[model samples]
Target: VITGARYPRLRRSGWICFGSWLAIAIWLAIVSPDGSSTKDARVKNCHVGGPEKYQRYVLGALLPEVDQFMLGFRLITSVDPLFTGEQASSLSNLTKTIYTDLESDPDFHALGSVMPGAYDELWARKFDHGHYFLYVPPGLDHKSPAPALVFLHGSGGNFKAYTWLLSRVADECGMVLISPSYGMGNWDSQGGVRAVEAALDDAGKDIPIDMNRIHLAGLSNGGLGVSRVAASDQGKRFRSLTFLSGVCDAAAIATDAFKKQWSGKPVLIITGTDDDRVPLNHVSSYASSMRDSGAGVEMSTYDGADHFLFFSHRDRCLEELSRWFTRQLAPALPSSKELKGQ
Candidate 1:
């Protein structure tokens, strides 16, 4: 009797609840530690509370799924130091860039719908001790024996968004995409190398991966890991290596051991001219050393771009990568004598 009769105040004032919620929303929109106005206050709140704070805004957005996906990426980078020894706050500029792009680009709103099953597929499968994300392109099966691209992520926690983004390349090039995750993204360690190998082995068992056509690629700190893995005894398994906004170890690349392993293999270095974290000169020097050591080196540099170019310049980057894979898989030309019926 007390439960039903004593709640008269709650039942009589529905407007009170709505008014309280409205007040809370107004306070969140107008207040911040920086003491700025509405938009600036929200931006400052994002910086103070991390990208998770963006969730409140995302809930009110038109494309919640795409906003959520972008939020996941911002959260990951906000917690880890992607610039090797730098602090997580070093990604502030990148976060701002993402926010700007999302507001201005209408096409970006449709990113989540591009690959139908990408989001669910990435989260559904767990392999190699739950350290990898595997994606098999549509129309590919055990009968096709498609090539594989093993991608390594940079420092920060690994999330499905990366595999989702790279799935475009896999779809276009008709290749299987395997992304292996290492704790805090320490891919330069033996454990990291083992994780990659384990993922490849496990994926190979379930899919038709052309062992000889495997390619290795990494981003940011992952680029350093790529060098480590390519220099190991397992190095001979990869046909090509790609680095995106990554720095190569100067001492390691100069050594005879590393040169011997990657000598004839194709190396692609994609970087930004204004990348202060991983300077253009450093990457250029690494490319020169690899080329001098007899490795087939290709360098692609973008002007006025920074370390976060992978996200900002996504389309061009994917196109270049897909083209590179096609070049690698192209059949050799027939000899002139054979053409002449000799």
Candidate 2:
């Protein structure tokens, strides 16, 4: 009887030891120094497991707050772990790249920390009604009011990343960047219009915004909002419109009232050929309708790119947008001769 009990206890202990060693070995293989497994690959592969597990081990191991935030974001956005579509894959890969860099790179992490605080100051001091992210490029002040580019975020909650990425346009083109946050990013109603107008009003109070130079832009579902807002009574406030990886409502834009409101205004659209979410053909057709409706519409298409081309092909998109903005501003700017005369 004593020998039998000892044998069972020994067997249990042996199995526990084996299991521990096996787990350690698997961990070592995944995090080996030989470069077989990389952090980027781990971040990109969502099917391995949920972001919770991945965040705990790989993504935000250094910053617990960031880890928690990412987990919350995943939940809010309803990111499917098993989603293998091109748009999902691209968005996942880009998001992972950004967070992983934030975790590993000190400079990026520091910028990420400082940006939110600045936005908080704006929200606390000036805007108290609605949520928004603002970025005023260097050298812009009350003495010389800068042009404003108001962007509407797509579904998946309004991320600071959108504002951060768009800051390049603000910096390059000397424009103020303001992105208004709508709940769940549904901006196709009266509330959406109010949110945008309220943000503009709040921002205008502190920052000198050139009302005539304001441009409205949107992405994905935001494109729908853009169409609705642009056709509202306040639609005349915007000087131009831009659609990225999105399209305007066909029925709305095809109306006589919309055409009358948007006539002579320049519109820029950039899209990808392989975007499964927003098909290229649909975008082209929308552009035709906009053009027919008297809006000066220009469309640029990228080859083999997907819905997340705004992120995947960031440089090209920004550069093109910057040039387009400059072109629009050129006509409004006083000629060299006029300046000399002044």
Candidate 3:
């Protein structure tokens, strides 16, 4: 747990602060000075900014970052449920799983959330006091173009949860990925959908995005959010919809507009058989609704996976998603004709 370089990085007070900032950066990534993994977004701006200008890369900070989990775990362990010794142990294991998944964060790493890497990750403001983070794929001499995947995370989750996966996955799939910090247990219908729409509109404005190839994916609670959004008038914007352990029955809480609007786009559903939290049965329930409504859908089931299958099997989950994106979202520069809308 020692984090000193034997000598200070600089003599100037400002630069010394900058060096300390680097330590903060490493610490924020959950890279233990003792032991941890480096499966996060590829980092180009490793050093902290200096005298010329000081800008903090606090994208994850505003939403879900390693630091939030670090603080949250301590809070979770001390909270109401884990009062007894046995319960504490179980809670400890659960927290450990969360840490493992975050350390191996798929979106940040897979999406290439860092500078001079493969892509650019940012945020777009929305009404209802909410905002959406953006992920734009890399460019060669500032002219490269690629497809995009807009993902939404479930309750008790934020953008950091997917940043690692998206960073790397974006590279492999040639897709830009974006997600917003909609808040835990609070799925703001209008806000969440608006954020996604804003991202798509922004991408379409420049760097070339295939409108026909646009797609939406969500997990757990977020699954419910996007599904509802897709079932609305705006849903037609995407070529397909993916529900991964989501609460597809958005009308119960969020909105019924989703039911009224039938993008009729292709659908892909994945559920973990052993998910104790949401259960594979829930997704099946949605499939029943879709089938009853004559909404075409395809489904896949994972064995021995938990409610957090996306985090538990990030590499595999993202690989499957990348393949799906490739089929659904044609690369922008490849052909405007390929875009169903363009």
Candidate 4:
């Protein structure tokens, strides 16, 4: 967890790095390399002065004009996550509110801030000596419940590393994405589990999250973490489980009682035949053990794919995974309302 001590250094370096990248990307959209432009050159000639001055125009009055120009054009397809029409407008307004809240709220500033983005994809905040990064789908209904996923990253991964793909998934699936940073620790450790729980609670407070649809997912060490968490009593709360490149020791965690409890719940295990780090045999064996114990488990395999196959087969994986997740979701129950402290 980044506290008051490390927070400043991270904020200074992290936000600035992200802000610098954002300013450059946005600036490139407003200006051409040859300095030949038809529209007013207010933003084209403006100099970037760190995060606070990122929006300053040649003339103060031109800022709104630049905003309009940006809103009007589709500068870059990858950087611009917002959709067209009313959805884009709603997301823009929500983004503004989130930014203002992060900047003006003393509690938020002292805790953490949003990860800067041309579209503001994610936010980073401290939790249990670790950090929890979150993304809410643009144009999410505040009054209606939306599904949420708690994603655990592998040993060498961080929140920023996976936010791009996860953000896209959240937008497509209408799910809230919560990724907890374990700071080099394995996710099954006591601290790791607590951090994940903290992340869920924090994300729930920020949006009208549907607890009934809450799902737990992980990759690599994260996949191992999912197995451990799902075997515990607390796992009963989740509607489903998705494992990517994950293998676990069935004897150590998946006891008879655990299998009995998970028998009715859905479990989707995705693996690659060519993943040497986690062999297909290990994952298949674990799945077999869970099935023998009466758990509802499904396994999917990709050919000619390695440990990093998800990166290569992203679209296919997301489409199938999204379908699996959608099928496992349960209708909002009365108890789900309590998850939001309503």
Candidate 5:
């Protein structure tokens, strides 16, 4: 048993265990240090033996014993770097520059280049009703296609906010990150849907983006807004969603449309047990709805996080976000039709 449990029921079967590790391996691939995806890049080969070995295991065995490998490495390696003000400041600066340029571009491309050696491209998208801030990878300038990640800001949040977090992510995974600034109405169900649908339309034409891998993520009010949008028009274009410090109860959002649009997609809900505004009850309600509806749902509760879960626990939230997204977006599995998910 990975946990060395005394009860046999605590142990997972070989197939389930392998599947779990495969999930972790995908997580690692997404979060690996710079250059981790380059063919033969050797900085972190934590995928059991190697990608080759894992591939062989998956092909031959009912399930390759991947869980033990993932569990073993995760247990020993400190996944997050030590917290430091200097690193945070640098990251903050890098992110701000990315968002700042998107809204008001001056062609000073060096803004996103702060994360040296990573490929990047910036765009100012037209939303018809308004304009949006966007970014994508120019990928080694090498004809390779890439997937897209759209970021939604919470209530009182804007496009530039996640610049820091998303920039780090973009560098780590070579992903295209689009952070759409929602001026004042981001939380409004109608407005939320408009911003997301526009962002998706913007990315679709601007880059060689893989439509199948699109994901929605937000913290606080933005999270709730995303749930509503995912339920309505945007659901058809997306595969899954992530909610941080928010949920889908209409009573919570003060809207009936959102209440009705709650359960059409695979959802990942994250909340701090200490959250005062939304509380664990709301999170439980939302998660229960998805699960009871047979949607591929997941939730995680941190012991002392609050309404601003992302600010207090950036590393953990981002880690889980990447982990959950990798599991849902990776190319290994057949798409789930259970929820007719977006």
Candidate 6:
């Protein structure tokens, strides 16, 4: 019986295995160094710039995958010249500058070249329930009933990260910038809405704010969150809303109450056509839907821009936002009697 053996011979190619191992080694060399993970390398090479760079590096190191996906880079490659202790001190000093020093500094232009605003002062405080960051424009005081902009930070960002940009906006628009943190680096958790309410109220106590001109603003996750909040009964408190790189879920606002509450209220949605995180088509469709729902909707787009469009188009955004807020809220200048009453 010349029947072949039931077992078949197996073939293994050392060359193929060696090639695979070589490719893996190359990838590791490119993405990592000295046996450390890419994340560790990024942290070791972290660089802190102004608020934007601080937000990028710190958030990248802490939330690598999410930050990379949104910001479009791991923000790490070459080694950082800063030592561990130096980096720690640098981060601390930056935090103090953004969150503590600027707040307490009586000089109006405390940020100097970092942000524009002559005589504009920044302040931050942690209340019993939430954290509040306020930017008071030049000449603003208990008597100046300035328009208030309640800013919400995106995921992996805090009031400190946005203080430079939003404070500048507040200065340009002649408004008070009020940024509140929900204790954590998030705005979609329980008590989130209440926390915002509390922060705004607390800020009102410190400075005269035009309740009728109060507006909600945010970018990315903050944008979506403000949209959701503005559609609720709680949103009636604000005069209008501005969303950057954010989209409102049509399904969530399908109800008539949401539409009715937002009806006649203006909403400005700014997005980039090339945003992968929040696709352009999605933002367009949401704006259309909101318009149909009787909300005064305005959409602005930056061509060939992605999720981080704000970094490049910030000046344009500020201009558009100021115009939109002025047009929708119509916050007239308070007279001497009004200021005194306030």
The best candidate by TM-score is: 2
Give the higher-TM-score candidate: 3 or 5.
Answer: 3
Model 6: residues with Cα > 4 Å off, grouped in runs:
1-129, 183-185, 331-342
User: Tens-digit lDDT track for model 3 on 274-336?
Assistant: 776676766777776765554567787889876667766666777887787676655337466
Quantify all predictions' global Cα lDDT against the true fold.
0.67, 0.69, 0.56, 0.60, 0.53, 0.59
Candidates, ranked, TM-score: 2, 1, 3, 6, 4, 5
Off by over 4 Å in 2: 1-90, 100-129, 332-342
lDDT of 6 by residue, 102-183 (tens): 4343232222121101001122323123445566766555586778888876654443446555656676677888776443
**Positional deviation of residue 277's Cα in model 1 after best superposition, in angstroms:** 0.9
Clashes of each: 0, 0, 26, 2, 4, 3
**How many angstroms is residue 317 displaced in model 5 relative to the true structure, after the best TM-score fit?**
1.5
Q: Which lDDT value does model 4 have at 78?
A: 44
TM-score, candidate number 3: 0.62
Give the lowest summed-lDDT range of ten residues in model 4: 41-50
- What is the C-alpha lDDT profile of model 5 across 13-79, one tens digit per residue? 7668889988976765443222122332111111111222212212111211222223323443354
Q: TM-score of predicted model 5?
A: 0.55
Local accuracy of candidate 2 as per-residue lDDT tens digits, 1-342 = 559869989999999999997787667445522211233221111111112122223222223334444455456345554334544545666777756744463322322221222233334432112656566775666577789998988865455566667777888888988787665566775577887887777777656899989999998888987887788877888988899998567877877777888999999999999887789989999999888889999999999888778878988998999999989877567789999998
Candidate with best lDDT: 2
- Candidate number with the higher lDDT (2 or 3): 2
**Ten-residue region with minimum lDDT total, candidate 1:** 40-49
* Reference-based TM-score of each model: 0.65, 0.68, 0.62, 0.59, 0.55, 0.60
* Better-scoring candidate (lDDT), 3 or 4: 4
- In model 6, state the lDDT of residue 337: 98
When summed lDDT is taken over every stretch of 10 residues in candidate 6, the lowest stretch is 41-50
Residue 46 of model 4, lDDT score: 14
